[model samples]
Target: MKRGDIIELIEDTTFYKKGKKAYFIGRSNFNPNKIEIVWVGEEQAYKDGDIDEFPARLFKQVEHGDR
Candidate 1:
């Protein structure tokens, strides 16, 4: 998806904490297939500056209705 989009972890659980919502920061500069995201919920495990990177295929853009 595009940058600034909200995405949800769907299939990839190895990196993401399943079901957590994240803000799409952007795709990896070194690899277009990967994306970077910042956790945005109350999950205390992820603190400030915490970021996650995963394959673009593993995330789905959150629809307006889903918000």
Candidate 2:
């Protein structure tokens, strides 16, 4: 997802970063091609496997007018 895309951390329910919980506001992407979402908080999960896959319905596309 691109910048400003609202995303929820479905996996790692116990994990949290930047004092936030559940939902996170997407700020950017580490790799646009890979569709990795980058938020304001630091990476909490150490391994890739630690992250659980979010269901299709959980992911909602937000309108980002311009870069």
Candidate 3:
């Protein structure tokens, strides 16, 4: 996913539960497969190497529209 895109946790994982809103910050500097994101409730802006990242396969891009 690209930076600034909204992502949702699509599957149950060891770290995050399903249905959490996160901002797609980009891929990890070390591992491109690891998509970095920050919880939306915590903060909207983020810097690489400063947050937890998960596998891109576990997340899906969230389309922006009315709730």
Per lDDT, the best of the predicted structures is: 3
- Summarize candidate 1's per-residue lDDT along 1-67 as a digit string, tens digits: 5666778888748555666778787888888899987766733534656667778888788843232
How many steric clashes between backbone atoms does each model show?
0, 0, 0
Displacement of the residue 55 alpha carbon in candidate 2, Å = 1.2
lDDT of 2 by residue, 1-67 (tens): 4544455543443444332222223332443223334333434652332333333333445444245
**22 Cα displacement, candidate 2 (Å):** 7.4
Worst 10-residue lDDT window for candidate 2 reads: 19-28
Best by TM-score: 3
Residue-wise lDDT of candidate 3 within 9-47, one digit each (tens)? 999877668998888777889998898788787663454
RMSD of each: 4.0, 8.3, 3.9
Superposed by TM-score, candidate 3 places the C-alpha of residue 54 at a distance from the truth, in angstroms, of: 0.5
Supply the TM-score for candidate 3: 0.76
* Candidate 1 vs candidate 2, lDDT winner: 1
Evaluate all candidate structures by whole-model CA lDDT and list the values in order. 0.72, 0.38, 0.77
lDDT of model number 2: 0.38
